[model samples]
Target: MAASIGSLLAEISGVEDPIEELQSLKTALLSIPVSALRDSVSGQRFDVIFSLLDSNEREQVELCVDILERILMALSPVNVVQNYRVELQGGLTHPKETVKILALMQIGRVVEHPDAVTEILNNHDILRGVIHCIGEEMSVAKQAVQSLSKLSHSKPGLDKLFQSDLLNAIKDVMATSDIIRYRIYELLVEISSVSPISLGYCANSSLISQLLSELTGDDILIRATAIEMVTALAHSPHGRQHLSQQGIMDKLSNMIRGAETDPLSSLYLPGLVKFFGNLAIMESPQQVCETYPAFLDKVFEMALDPDPAMIGVALDTLGLLGSTVEGKQILQKTGKKFKAVLLRMSKHGSLGATNLRVRSLDAISQLLTLLPEQQTEDLLALTESWFQLLSNEPMDMIRNIITQPFPELHCSALRIFTAIADQPWGQKLMMSTPGFMEFILDRSTGQTKEAKDGKFQLVGTLAGSSTAAEILGSQHYLRMKTYLREGPYHVTAVATVSTEGAD
Candidate 1:
């Protein structure tokens, strides 16, 4: 089977119609065993496989590199880390662009291997070869630089890749080729995932200035990718300030409001919403209100939108923003409108509708906590309505709302239920639901947010059977007891635990 697979790969690797053969070779390569590749002790056969590569012509070299990519991909994870380090150091100057390309890809494939990247970092020669290749045309340059960026950011003991000369290489490539600059955006995304700290490198190295300048470029991809990288950078304090300076949300909002044929609008909008929300949470709410009033209005428009997803983003943004004082007031003024929409949505809407309702509940919950204590009835009425819906709603929607944004809305809903039990009608409403006891038990003991005894003592206390159990559980149930020890503590305690689940 090994010999037949090798011969087939060889035949396809060197065929006249390289593209078609390359595709077939890629499919066949997946079936080949990595163990067989490592045990290729016949030097003659290995040489024959290597020589089949057409290294002289650009097109052929790319095709051959694609095949080698499949081979390396198959061998990855099983091949020893030291073998890759040795191959990469030796392949850097192997006199063929195709071979160097394959080496760069192999380096990336094995990047997660135990000590492979550490070896590359210690051996500066291989790193320099990768930097030199960054000047190649756009596609190859993108692949090489992205691998280098990932190594520099996430791979431990590879800080040496960020040395002065390599940094200069990234800048030079971005300066010349828009394609390479676009790749910078891709590389930054990978960098952010592995090590969010590396966004600072992109911001400080003048890449951010160039990227923001390119936002107005004719290339829609360049603009969209730039916005994405900028968002990742916004994860840091310095990056957030940089985003503000570039007026990123204004640019993104323009893109959102404008008509772009680009397919990335969906991708762009979610991140943009998240960035604005992060800014609203991190910076002063008054500052956000002062700075981007139109932005705030646009977000509110999204919350009341017909699309469930759009409404969800809008609600999440509002929730994040409502965590601030001025933002809370803004949400309060808009709450009744959003709540009406949510109540309408909950009637016959899909699972997403229920999820959006929970988000609305969370934002309203936050706003209520910030409201004046003497005037909390309006919010209390809305809370009562939401709890009633949760008790009688579909099982899936109830589970989704509880599990979706753990702890935040879950804790808020529990608080609202406890508040409702104080009223005679509220106590009667909760007791009418046959599933109420089972739902509470599921939430308290089934590894959901309420299971954390530290964060959710109230739920446990309300579920504990008798006075002695309540007293015993109450010792460690600080948050729960605090809710109990409040006004009408004794009157609400029995109603809180009333269960009609089973005999």
Candidate 2:
């Protein structure tokens, strides 16, 4: 059967085969096992299939299309892709667009097989067809890109894929159409996520410039996708440099301004903010500080908006921005105006001096930390008035500070409290804060153990403690027991630090 098919291919190449011969060859190609199709003797047989698949003759082309469909449905079995190179090119350029599309689709479906991927890389014209389909129509183009993702899967192969100029083709598709751009952006992200080094190739291409242009696009989804891709690019040291060179800061700042209240804008804001925050290199900390006040204004505006979650996010970012050195320098330049706004905000009841107020308070705390010691004095004085508010705040509120999105704040605040407890003057300020000590005591309770001798083996990791055995020493246990019975707060919440948690 294979020999007959080979004969038919040679005969058909003459353009003089009887129609019946073409028909029989098509049936045989359809019946041949994909594994057998990879056999040495099957080369000529595949050539025949490719010939008919590429034929300009109407019936021959249709038959070839159906056979290609069958082979693809068979999972392009056995990777019989090598010897069919010329034939594959023929299908890629078939006169009918639908046939050309199907050929590319078939190639994509099987392209996961190493040999088939190699075949794709080897035939530049066929690879071009795949990219063309990606640029031609949204659905078809997306499908074409989906195939490119497979070629970029394995580590070495991703490097090879880039070497083949396929990565550049993907970048070209992104440059051409929104749908193509969307698919290509996501695929590049997946590839980069797997092998960050591949991003260098993407960076060298026009990917950053094109994506930056899309930042200003009217389509929110397009803009969001572009930002996501930018986030991936900014994740790597190499990619971040490319982004800086692309003038991403100015463009992103503009996005923050225009989209502040658009409702759809914040969808991309956190990630964009995080990415900008994470970039290892920036044009200048001063330049960033110059632009950041505009961002802070938007953030403060969002905080005052009706949305509670948005308010929290805004407060959090304000806190993040304020914690930075440049942000502090910027805050310093603003001087008394900044201090005044903070004082006024502290007195404002909308933040309510409640747990819901923690986000705001935490932001204030970060701002205070960012200030110089002398500069923080005024804020510390303001805190004396809100001291009762903190004193009355729920254990859950304190627990949340230690437990929530930024556990570092909770830890920092607690450590400060611990330090204050150790000072004569500071201890007076915190003397009435019974729950705070009990909170630390609860966290330390896990260290206690019952010895085989029926006594306690106390284990502890207290800061500045000389030894674990010294913790809850006989005298201390009595003190702890008395404190537990008459404790200001009877219950405490212990937090586990996971990556999703404190860590």
Candidate 3:
């Protein structure tokens, strides 16, 4: 096997058609298992492969780099990579652009292995060489960015890149060509995601303005990338504060409002919505409501969007806005239409659409709490529509909402239930639902202390209503009474409450 492999390598090095010979060599090398390759040869195969990296022929160099990349990726021995590290690094600055690109590609594969990452990090010049290629031909520049992205995956590799002058090189290349701007933006975003503080250097007024300008560019892809970069920056408080000082909120609000009037502008609506959502975290609900009134209205409109993802995000944004006193007031002013939209969205059937449903219910729950005494009639009217809309699969939907694995959604469902319990008509409607009593009894029997307590409170609330009291006293309440007596002590205490004394 060793003699045959050596024969193949000799043909690859000396053959007239290098590509054909290299392909044959790659096939033969791949046929040998890594263990066999390691045991059979005294590093001669790797030396033969490494010798090609210095060849005058670009095709031979690229083919060798490609083959080496495969070998490195296949869990080859550390010495296999370590022996050629210097040669690979040298190829980064080779006169031929093709060789440099292939070398960078091979280096990317190398760094993907944990063993090679430490070796590569020790050589800062190799990373600097890759960054220097960012200003080369477009294809080469893209390969450089791809390599940098791979290197950025490791904290040490990423730290080396940040400590270097790569950002300045990125800025220079970004200014010269919109062609490579998206790739550069991607690298920046990747770095920011891993080390947000490293991106502080680019958080100045100039870079922010550049990104904001891209937000309004005619190209949708550019706008999308800019949105991603801004989102990454917003991950850090410093980045968020920097963007806020540059009026990011106002710009995002303008983009959102513009999306309302122009369908083309609406292309940025989802990105703008996400960006606005992140920015909202740095702000109080009152500040958000005051800063972006038009944007907030647009968010409510998106809550009913046909796309589940859009509806999910819009619902979350609304929930944030309704998180405060002033924000809740603003949502309430949208009136019954807003409540109706939320109720309709709460019944979405798609799997993983629970968050959207949960957020919609949460927003409605907030509105319920904010409603004044004078709005009791409106509350009853809204609850009637909720029950009617959910009437078809009422039991299934209620079970899903209350039993959701996430505590937030679970609690949000209970909040909606509690809000309904406050309304006289709602209590009667809830008591009459087919699964309503079973749900309460099942919950009362739950092992979790919190669930049992919540169920107890809900049941106690229903027992206060005369209509519910009549229903509870009937034979239908026998199951609950049996569970209370034989079930957990908490359930027994809740069931023993007198209807007259409950309210």
Candidate 4:
């Protein structure tokens, strides 16, 4: 190992330019796992790394930092802490954001144990490094916050988190930027969600009250941001109970009720809609919609609006809402609103802005999709009803869709077909529709890798289902089974033997 480093240095010494030499070293070192390349690391390796770091060249310093993280990742946490504890601690406060994340991940991996938590508790530098990470970069901030939350799983760990040092650190960051402030709030909410005792610990700070109140703040954008953190808070029973007592409804009421009844006149907030929509899917879909009736009203209104942005958000929200069975049930209860949304979806699904068209197909697929186990007689009837009503010319429209030059649309439409391929009613429709079965059997139709996979998924779904054989008629079903056997991109191999005049 020493000889290898020696040879590397000897080779780079003759290079004409310093930066080129450093870059060459970096490239060579990266190609080899220098940290894990040997069974035992030599002290010369550390010396060479420190020498490079001290050179103060930006490229060399950056490479050293990255290499440190590479070493940290390659080693076990215990080995890292035991052998490179000083450098590991230095890495936690590294200027490069990715190194900070890698260092925090190392700590987070081991700190799940009580002893590890206690050990980290005593090391104030490591603790401060982790907290500083909370304000560094968005991705690192999340890692730091999550690492700190793991400490709260124990009493002493809880003390460390709620202590003046950590609180002061977070308080300092809260003063920097609104985004960083919310990062701190997000951490508190996470700790609070652990248990009732943890929630009580977080309550000692004024941040909790500030967070809940901001959920109803005058600025809608900030309110939406607050709701993102608070949504996680709602996952816990105590957290939900706290939100209820704190008047969560008061925070959301006005947002649901747009400024005007007229769809065009109303304020359109994609994030605001997503907040309520996601909460509904995660919690009680029916109850969330019922408590905030205007939530769906806005979604429907947005779907009907002419603005492409509104339509895009509406498509995304609808896709999310219709993904689960409970979500489907809630949509079903919307009656004509559901039908109107489906109607709008078909307009986009068949032809519109590229993204909206893709989203419409995805949403319809999600709405129609059901697992084999979840399919009851009622559920099958629901899916059939959904397919039959996507548009007035639902059958012919989709049939024409597959023939288009757009591969994305072709794939999305194929996904919709994949979603329904297992159901009895969907099979009946395919059987009755002329040339649909031929499209299913024809592998030549899929133009791209994604489209090929999509078509194969539909064929696989049909070939694997119990009822497809009987309902699709044994002959058509047999071809589908053959398609599945050959796989998505299969082409028949042809061989030819050519003979010259001599032969």
Candidate 5:
């Protein structure tokens, strides 16, 4: 098998149509043991393959690289690195752009192997060769960036990457085309994630100024990528401090505010919102609100966007913003309108809509705990409508909403039920709906402790009312009593009260 596979590989270089032969060779080679193939004829085949890298025919070079990539993937990385180090390093500097890219891609695969990583990183010439290819065609530059990203996985490799003239090379490529500029930003972001100090190096005022300038650029992708890079930087304290010092918050605010009028702003509004959220992570919410007074309003507008994904992101940001006192105050200023929008979204049945709906309820639940009762009264008033919707909803739909995979939605739904139990009108409406209590009881059976406690509270609240009590009657009341007694301390207290009343 090994000799036959080697024969097929030998035919690849001499075939009239090399691609078909290469495919056949690749399929045949994959079946044989790598050790067997290596022992039998891989050395001679490797020589034949390496010679083709010098060929003028692009197809032949491409096929050779493809075949080499598969062969390298199958063999031991250590052996391949040791045996073919010189040839692989030479391919990195190969004059043909395609050869350079395929070679870098093969190197990327090798870098994934722990043994080859150190070997590749130790070769400074090969490292420099990979970086030099960044100035090549856009496709080649992307491949080079990916290779560097892989190399940066290790501390030593990352250190080597920074010690080189990578930053200067990036700046040089930034002048060439937007595509390469984007790849550079992407590579920097990837490196920063592994070694946050990489962000510190790129956090210079000049580069940040350039990124901030692109935030409002006419090209949508450029603006989005700039926002992405900025967000990535905001992950670390050093990056956040530098970005804040450079006034990124103000630029983000301006873009968000301008999104109301500029049609183009829509393209990058979600990204700008994300950047603002990242900034919020490191900056105080009060500080964030102070910098951008329209922050909540802009985000609330985005929550109401037609795009469900945008709505989900907006809701997530609102959850973050509502965590701080200053943010809650800003949210309260538009509390009624915001709550109304959320309540409307909560009833949407689409999967994306349901997710945002769940998130919106959680956000609203948090806001209710912080805002003044009177300030939240209008928001709370919406609970009757929510109950009305639940009462009228199909049994299966209600079951689905309460038992969906996301426990947050289940918990949020129970919280809404608790809210309904707080109101006289809501209680009256809920008791009037047949199977409502049973549905709550069914939902209560297998919930988390927190959810069970919430259900127990709602049951106790409803059981306290004479009108609801008459509807629950002796049998249902006994069942509620048993459920409560089996619950935690607070629930047992409620259960004790009912049993004493029965006596």
Candidate 6:
């Protein structure tokens, strides 16, 4: 932006090939010595270059950001960010997304240095500019969040962003759109994930508490929208403790309980169920269920709903609740009603919506699946009884599911079988089920690659289980082990002895 480059940038409007002219100017600008420009530069020269960056006359945005970055990089050698502080912050509010992105990135560079982080934070214009970028493009908003996060590392920087007038400015922008509000929450959660002190910073911002309040607020839509951020905050140990301490867990539980009678519950019930389900998995499934009986009741209620969207959410939550040893044990406590739900979904063609059916079987399989480390005698018996309750003959029922042409169902069913393949009772069912063992040995079936992998994994689990050798018999056990060693796609090479007089 000094006189030499400033004049070319200024005259570019008169040229027919402005892009080419800008590119050539950028190249020459890069060749000039940084010390020379820093000596001759003033704030007004920066204004000249920034005007070109903000120009609506030419649409060459990449050229503008590139030229600005080159000049900044030259100034960067001596940490002269304050020289063009006004223009760089002003760049954030420019209508173009590229300019906003460059401004956020340059601010990020300052935040990295502890000594200089406050230089950007102490300036009210730069703070406002950063908050203003949240409504811009996703790429730009993401950088803005990153820059804010970098500033949050130290005490003074954290105090300024969280407790100052800029916090109010952020809330005002958050009111602009759904996307922008979520981005602000993302920024808060990102900071909150750092430590309790960082979350305390978020708490001071009021936006964090505001978001949690909306999760139970009278507006059903706000409650639904706020659940996602709550789930995000729950990802950290401190956040979960924070949420639990604030009574949000109980408030959501009460909200869902009342939603059963609310006609508007359909709008938000799925998100609420998803949140508790994730909470159940993240913390203690048994503890969450014991603490909030209504939550699980709503999950099972949603499970059998006529609507696919609600039921899909229900099934996913059930799967998460069944993923751990404790989760599986608690789900087994639900007993007959849940098993009936699984049976209806297992009967393929009627519930032909592929995702719903896939999710159902996946949930059921996970509920019954027992890992070796987790397989106590009590759990083994629990899994075996649930399998039997699924149908008159669980083997035939699963075999039918396996016969379905859908590759996803096929893989999911095989996973179910893999889950039970190790149980002593499960092994006995396979022995007497006629071709069930043959099914394990047969290699000629035409199946998708995923199905083939599923079959191989089934054999692998069977071969690896402790009592398989005794229960499956030595010959069959050795063959399954061989199949495991051979890998999923292994093809047996048949030997052909050459005849003496063939030619």
- Candidate number with greatest lDDT: 6
Model 6 over residues 199-306: C-alpha lDDT tens digits?
998897777887887776787777788887888898899999999899988888888888868999999888878778888888899999889998888877777778
Query: Order of all candidates by lDDT, from best down to worst?
Result: 6, 4, 5, 3, 1, 2
Q: How well is each residue in 362-473 modelled by candidate 4, as lDDT tens digits?
A: 8888899999997999888988888889766576888678778888888888888888888878888888888889978886787699988888888889888899888988
Candidate 2 lDDT (Cα, whole model)? 0.54
What TM-score fits each model?
0.50, 0.47, 0.55, 0.82, 0.61, 0.81
Q: Which ten residues in a row have the lowest lDDT in candidate 1?
A: 39-48
Most TM-score-accurate candidate: 4
lDDT for 364 (candidate 2): 59
Taking the tens digit of each residue's C-alpha lDDT, what string does model 1 give over 370-394? 3323225555564455445543553
Superposed model 6: Cα runs more than 4 Å off = 1-59, 63-87, 113-118, 175-179, 345-350, 441-449, 491-503
RMSD of each: 11.7, 13.7, 12.1, 4.5, 10.8, 5.6
Question: Which candidate model has the greater lDDT, 1 or 4?
Answer: 4
List the global CA lDDT of all models: 0.55, 0.54, 0.65, 0.76, 0.66, 0.79
Across residues 1-503, which tens digit of lDDT does each residue of candidate 5 receive?
66676677678658666667776776676666666655544454477678767777777777777677667766677777777878878887787876777678777877878977888877777777777777787788789888888877776665676555655655776677787666667777666655445555444414546766887778887888898888887787766776678877777887777777876666687788877776765677766766777776677777777877677778778767765555655555665776655555455432455567677666544443322233355554543443344334533444466677666667776665554454556555566667776877664353577666667776776565444556556777777676666653333223433555564
Model 6 TM: 0.81
**Cα lDDT for residue 364, model 5?**
49
Residue 478, model 1: lDDT of 50
How many angstroms is residue 126 displaced in model 3 relative to the true structure, after the best TM-score fit? 4.9
Cα shift from native, residue 25, model 3 (Å): 5.8
Q: Candidate 3 residues 31-70, lDDT tens each?
A: 8887665654555646667766776877787778767666
**True-vs-predicted CA distance for residue 201, candidate 2, Å:** 3.0
The deviation in Å at residue 307 for candidate 5 is 9.1
